[model samples]
Target: MHTAPQKFSRALTALAALTLAAGSAHAAAPSYVGTWASDLAQCKVPQERPEAPLVLQEKRFDQYETHCTFSSAEGAGDEWKVKANCQVEGDAQAYDFTLTVSGDTLTLTDDAGSQDLLRCR
Candidate 1:
């Protein structure tokens, strides 16, 4: 009960549907292009200086702009900014770091030095 013309038409229709679905799926994905900021306590610090919290803000991926406000428990605070490159690890959406990630820590480097940003969930 199947004709060659009908088979060809059905195949074309299926192909068209597949193409449309693929295009829509690609378009619906969110591009990581915004400024993300988090509280100072969210970032992990070195064990020697564990009493201080660091505020971190990242703007633009290509031009990694970070603002940090680190304050010691005793009411001392220091702020700094560093420009570098950044990228996301694997295909994760919530876990992005600067281009200087090493081992399990995300690193930020500039004319000053490098700092590691441990991922905190």
Candidate 2:
């Protein structure tokens, strides 16, 4: 009832499925999704800090009293451009920020200026 060719094809299909599953199992989160701070000491501060740690999610970020929800983020592994509506000191504002990451350092650039941060462990 079973032909050699059919068995070979089935085996190949199973192998392909196994390979895909293995690859996906080892997939990692994007490099930009993490907590970053000015230094390790800053990581011990509150959830996020104005001049220290910055907590980032896929579509939002928080630093001290500043909370931002971004509409879109465009970029690759270690760099991204984000457009967000944020509340800073109780005032609403629109902001566009550029984030670049290298090793443990994260550099964020905005209308005001650029600041470098370290990844929190």
The model with the greatest lDDT is 2
lDDT of 1 by residue, 1-121 (tens): 9899999999999999999999987763111212222334534443234333332333333212222222211111122233333332222223222333333344554546666555344
**Looking at candidate 1, what is the lDDT of residue 74?**
17
Best candidate according to TM-score: 2
Residue 37's lDDT in candidate 1: 21
Model 1 lDDT on a 0 to 1 scale: 0.39
| Candidate 1 TM-score over all chains jointly | 0.30
lDDT (C-alpha, whole model) for all candidates? 0.39, 0.88
> What is the Cα-based lDDT of residue 44 in candidate 1?
47
Q: List the residue pairs that clash in candidate 2.
A: none
Over 7-105, each residue of candidate 2 has an lDDT whose tens digit, in order, gives 999999999999999999987766777899877998888854456588888889888888899899999899999999999989999999999999989
The 10-residue segment of model 1 with minimum total lDDT is 69-78
Give the Å shift of residue 42 in candidate 2: 0.8
lDDT of 2: 0.88
